[model samples]
Target: MKKTVHVVGAVIENDAQQILCAQRSPSMSLANLWEFPGGKIEAGETPQQALKREIMEELDCVIDVGDKVEDTTYEYENVIVRLETYKAKITEGAPIAKEHAQLIWKKRIELPALEWAAADIPAVEQLTK
Candidate 1:
């Protein structure tokens, strides 16, 4: 049976109303695809906690997580991904891509121009709508 990985993503929007997007590094599984910055939910941690920790680790920034944005379950070749995205705002420090190839802030309308990871598509669509 394929294992399911539950993950949280943050749709961080700045004062300019642009959303933060991260590009997966060459070494990452979904290399070169864009995604919201976040990671897997560790045991015993609430989704909010995992999101905070992940943003700090992956983006070197602190965020205030808000309402849930979207939830999607996608099956890949080797695993099933359950991704939950939430609205967020950076509270401390600017984002610096620590694990990704790069980071960009884009308007919701422009989000569809980039190739996104499959699991993140639903959230992107929601944000653009």
Candidate 2:
């Protein structure tokens, strides 16, 4: 049986209206693909709490998690991921790529142009709508 991993993601938008995207590092399971910048939800943490914690740990920044944008399950070859995404705004510090290969801010229309992680595609589609 495939392990189901519950993860939380953030669609962090800046004042310029561009969404923050991160590239998974080479050592990650899904390396080099773009994602909405978050991580697996730790046990006992709410989605919001997980999002806040993941952003802090991954980007060295604080964020205020907003409404949930997507909640869907996607199966990778090795695991099934339930990715829950929420709209977020940075509240402190700058986003520094601590665990990712890179970070980019792009407009919604440009989101589809990049190769995104399979799990993040649905939220990207909804954002572009």
Best by TM-score: 1
In the range 37-123, model 2's lDDT, one tens digit per residue, is: 999888889999999999999999999999999998999999999999999999999999999999999999999999999999999
Count of backbone clashes, every candidate in sequence: 0, 0
The lDDT per prediction is: 0.97, 0.95
Q: Which residue runs does candidate 1 get wrong by more than 4 Å?
A: none
Question: lDDT of model 2 at residue 91?
Answer: 95
Off by over 4 Å in 2: none
Scored against the true structure, residue 72 in model 1 reaches a CA lDDT of 99
Give residue 40's lDDT in candidate 1 (0 to 100): 98
The C-alpha RMSD in Å for every predicted model, in order, reads 0.4, 0.6
